[model samples]
Target: MRITNNMMTTASVRNINKNMERLSKAQEQVSTQSKIQQPSDDPVVASRAIRYRSYVARVEQYQKNVDNVTSWQEVTDSALSDLSDVMQQLKELVVQGSSDTLSDSDLAAIKEDVTQLQQTAIDTLNTSYGGRYVFGGYATDEEPYSMDADNNVLFKGQLISDFNDNGDEQAIKANIGYGTSVTVNVEGQDVTGMGSGNLFDTFAKVLDGLDSGDVSELSDTLDAIESNTDTILAAQADLGARMNYVSMVGKRLDNDYTTYKELMSNNEDVDMAEASAESATASTVYEASLSVGVKVMSKSLLDYLA
Candidate 1:
């Protein structure tokens, strides 16, 4: 094995280039504040980061679903509350008209009041949320209830008298979690006599009773009025349950968001303290290698002869 100047110089240059490369990588890690600048630097960490980021993205999407569901529920709750209040007012007016102590004019005024309340109920059932009807069920773009020129109540374009054919309809829902969804609406038919007493029909009875001076007829409406109120209460209860479920899912999503983010950080994010230390060590080694290479190259065979 002959010791040649070419071999010594070649080995020293290679060592110096290797140290420079190490320094460049360490400095880049520090500057970028990332564990790896490219996936090729660390495939395992890159794969894990991808999975964690995807988890974060999914959590965000489900969170948006939860938010939209919450908005829908809030709108539904408001409409139902107003509807309940209308029922209460109708009951009070019915009780007032139940007494025969009133004059003809008083009965007439009561009839007017009943008519206005009936219209109000009709309007309430047609309520919309975010440009979509709250009670519209599957047909959110259209009103649940409407009134024709004859003051005949209509539900989904069918006469109220005939709308009961649909019976009970399922509420619309939004998925807020994996395998979990929240119902955000109460069917409008439930208030208009589908599986419940017809509120408009009850209003008609009240008006008729006042028109005929029939105190007994108005008294008979207490049962119908009570039934309508119970229906509203039940709808409110169901909405509340859905809201609770959404809240629980939202909390879980929040937790998942935090967890996925932490995992991503652990997998991909750089540690400033450690990265800085590594950069400094690599820099020092590179400088030392350059010094040694200069010394080794300075004393080549030609330089010794000079």
Candidate 2:
């Protein structure tokens, strides 16, 4: 085949274009600090980077869930602690009211204290966190317990069995990991005697017993108050366990997030030093290609004719 000037010029232009492309890619990597600016740059690396990024995002979300769970559990624990203190105070009042030496006026004063204690317990039961009732089961938007005009405690939340379609009275849960979740609440019935009966019924009865000077009934209320105190204690224990689980999961998620970030860096981020070196080399080669193309194009018969 005969060599032609047109063919030579075309070939030189193609080589210059190829060299410029390499140089451009190297410059992009150095400037952006990324191995691939587009998926087409390196499909395999880009795919792996995508997966690693997804994992990192998921770990971040799980950490957020763990944080939310911790907040809810902390609020629940604090409220339960308050309820426990109230129960203990009520128990003390019950014991004092049972004494036969107390006068009518003294009994009336004790009843007043009992009423205050009952109201305190009610407030504790209606505790809210982040604008949602912590003890309302899945019906978190509503108060779990309230007092009517007659001072009777009313249940305003879902039943334990009605919390979910599975009929399990599980509290609100947070997804902390793969196939893992933590319950972050204690239902009203579990702690405040909302479903079984009024936790403060014995408090009211003790008030009545004091009004009539009935020592026997006041003495009996001591046992009922003890039972309610035990219930609150049990709920606190459960909340503590859930809190522990959430803390452990949070730690694991932290470690996972660190690992995911490292993996993503390895997959997608460019080594600055190496990319700089490559960019320098590509620049030198591209300039040499331009020089060679210019030298070839200048050696033309038309130049001699001019």
lDDT per model vs. reference: 0.85, 0.84
Give candidates' CA RMSD values in order. 2.4, 3.7
Q: How accurate is candidate 1 locally (lDDT)?
A: 0.85
15-65, model 1: which lDDT tens digit per residue?
999999999999999989999888999999989988998999989999999
TM-score for each predicted model, relative to the true structure: 0.89, 0.85
Task: Please provide, for model 2 over 1-306, each residue's C-alpha lDDT reduced to its tens digit, 9 standing for 90 to 100.
Answer: 998877888889999999999999999998889999889989999999989989999999999888888988898899999998998998899889889999999999998998998888878888998999898788888876777677666666334222233445746777889999877788887776643334756666777898899999889888888888898899899889889988998999999999989999998889999999999999999999899899878778887688
Let me know the TM-score candidate 2 reaches against the reference structure: 0.85
Best by lDDT: 1
Count backbone clashes in candidate 1. Answer: 0
